[model samples]
Structure formats: structure tokens, C-alpha cells
Target: MNNFIKNLLLSNFNKLLQSTKIACPKENLHNSNRLKFYNPGKVTYDGKLNCGITSYLTSFMLSYHNIDHKVWLSKYGFGDYLEDHVHITTNSGLLIDTTYRQFFIDYRSDGNCDYYKYLFETCEPIFVGSPNEFDLLKKSIERQNIKVFGSLNQDIKELSDFWKQDINITPKMNLYDMRKSNEIHPTLLVEIPSLIQPLIT
Candidate 1:
């Protein structure tokens, strides 16, 4: 990594470490109020908090700051179970993981969780080079390749639709289908664009 990028990552890392508050609840996973706690407003008020919430907040911050990046998910197999971890990728495909500190915190607080232990030992602040360099650290990581605002627009719409369904009823759309769906409300199309201002020539 170049000195500039190294310094940039360190600065951002320190800022996030000092400013962001941890919000992932310690108990009652199923009965917890997810929307109330994990929404953008709450996250902004409390910090990124967890993997999924952190990824969304980081992505939004990157866009607002005019940083060229994409959010990527890394899936790991722990015996019969698979878990997804989210991080960010620069325009050059470099990896940036701002919330890695949480893993260390969780591991130190409770060593019983094997996943956090593995992550705390393995994860680094930034991957420090190309996507291939980052890939060398983790096996079976999936990059969403969402390099532009347009890519996120559809996924956001599908997510909105999925959430609109009845609480007891499951949506007909599968996870993959919802993520890749293209149809969106025209009125909501301006949301991302407004956050990311156009570059001046």
C-alpha cells in the first residue's frame, strides 16, 4: 500500500474507533427490535455497531465523502453453517474493513464465540492492496461488485419491498433474487444520487 492510502486508512480507523459506539445487543436475538435498533438513524446516532449495520453506514459515508468504493461480502464455512461478513472495496479493488475492531472487542469480552475468536485473530484494519491480495487472507469471499449508485438502487428497492410484507408471511422472493432485482420505484431513485453528488469536470 502507498503511504497516502496507509495514512488515510489509519486516520479513518482511529476516527471510527473513537467515535462509533457498539450497538449489537448481547441477548435475546429473535425478540430484539431489529428495525428500531438497526435503522440508519439509530446507527448514525450510535455508530456502525455490527457487521451488516456497519457495512451500510460505511458505504453511505464513502458515498457522501465521494470515495469510489463497493461493499463486498465474505462467506465462511464453520462446519455445517455459513456466515457472511461485510467489508468495502475501493475503485482499484483494494479492501477496507473499518469495523474489524469489534471482532477483537467481542472476542476479548467472550472467548466462547469461536467465530469472533477466529476473526479477531485473522482480521486486519485494511487488506493493503488489490482484491487478489485481500482474497489471499480469506477463502470463498464474495464481492458484490457494486461500483456505482445504480447497482445499489435495485437491491435497496427489493429490500424495501421485502420488508413491506406481513410480519408472519415470508416474501416469495429469495435472498439472491431480491438482491439482484432491477425494478424500483421512480420516486425513490433520487435517494442515492442526492447523497452522492456528481463530480465536477
Candidate 2:
């Protein structure tokens, strides 16, 4: 079955490459041509999990959508933007962050939620990953129209729930992340990026 899928992907890769659109920082794009792949590091709004699945997924989705963005990793190495929430452009682009709690619950104070509120009201943010986070995001938004994307597969029960709802979930597969490590080639484990080709095309 895997071989069949691989063959199908290989056969249609050209079409996917052509149809797909990716936007990246101009500097990154120029560098991308020279490097074998992109290796975006993990980051968050606070000095918490310097790395996370959400951080990596953000870069992956950007690559998937063909969009380039620079995450403001403050010089102090903490994305305190959640606390110091500021106005930002939304229509042209957005910022993304992922967390386990539903609706910024771990935030030490109302400031964090306020920041998210600002983000929702101003530059619409597109958040994805973790079902708990999604539930919180909706409730906090107040405005029923705010939209965020999320998913998780931590246990069989969750998977069963997802299946029961007939939600659009992708089958998991290993691909590659261009991030370099000491022993491994920069490429790390990744979901099947090529899978989107069929959905998009």
C-alpha cells in the first residue's frame, strides 16, 4: 500500500510542484535555492517550549502554502509578544502559535488572553494543532466568527472521535525536514507534504 502511494506521488510530483504556491522571506527564498532544504527552528510566544510540533508545523504549512514569514523570536529568545501584544497586519499575512491548553489557559494573567484578543480583532491569526487549543481559542474570541484550525492524535479515543465526526484528517506518513542535525542530514521526519497535491488540484 505504501509503495502504491509512493508511486502515485512520484508520478504526479511535477504537477504538484507546478500548482503549489509558497511564500517565504525573500532572503529565505534566495537562500533556499542554494541550500538543499529549509530548517526552521521551534519557537513560541513565551520562553516556554523553545521547540514544539506546532513550531515545526508552522514552517511546514508555510512551505505547503508557499508563504514565507519571519517569526519574531525576541532577542531575549522569548516570544513575549503574547504579553506585550501589539497591533499587526492581518489581511496580507498572519502570525501562528500552538499550545496544549485550551484558549491560552496557561497564561499567568489576563494580559495573555488580551493579546490573543487583539490578534483576533486585528491581524487575524491562523492557529492550528491540538484540539484543546482550538476550543479555548473559540471561546476567548467572543466573536463567534473567529476561525482557527487545529488537530491532534494523542490516543486511540481521540482518533476514534475524529473518525466518528468524519473530519478531514490526513493519513500520516514520513517525509523530510531540511533542518540539519549533527549526524543526520538536515532532513528530519515530516508528514506527507505531497499528499496535499490531490486535495488542492
> Candidate 1 on 163-188: residue-level lDDT in tens?
11122111211112222235441322
Task: Enumerate residue pairs that collide in model 1.
Answer: none
- Cα deviation in Å at residue 37, candidate 1? 31
lDDT of 2 by residue, 1-201 (tens): 323333333344334323222211121211121122223211112212322233333344344444443333222223653221111111234423332222222222232233333432342223432335444554554332223213221221121121022221121211113322223322332223332333245
- The candidate scoring highest on TM-score is 1
Where is the poorest 10-residue window by lDDT in model 2?
Answer: 23-32
Q: What's model 1's lDDT at 1?
A: 32
**lDDT of model 2, residue 62:** 45
Candidate no. 1 TM-score: 0.38
| Model 2 segments more than 4 A misplaced | 1-53, 75-91, 100-103, 106-201
Worst 10 residues of 1 by lDDT: 161-170
lDDT accuracy of residue 33 in candidate 2: 16
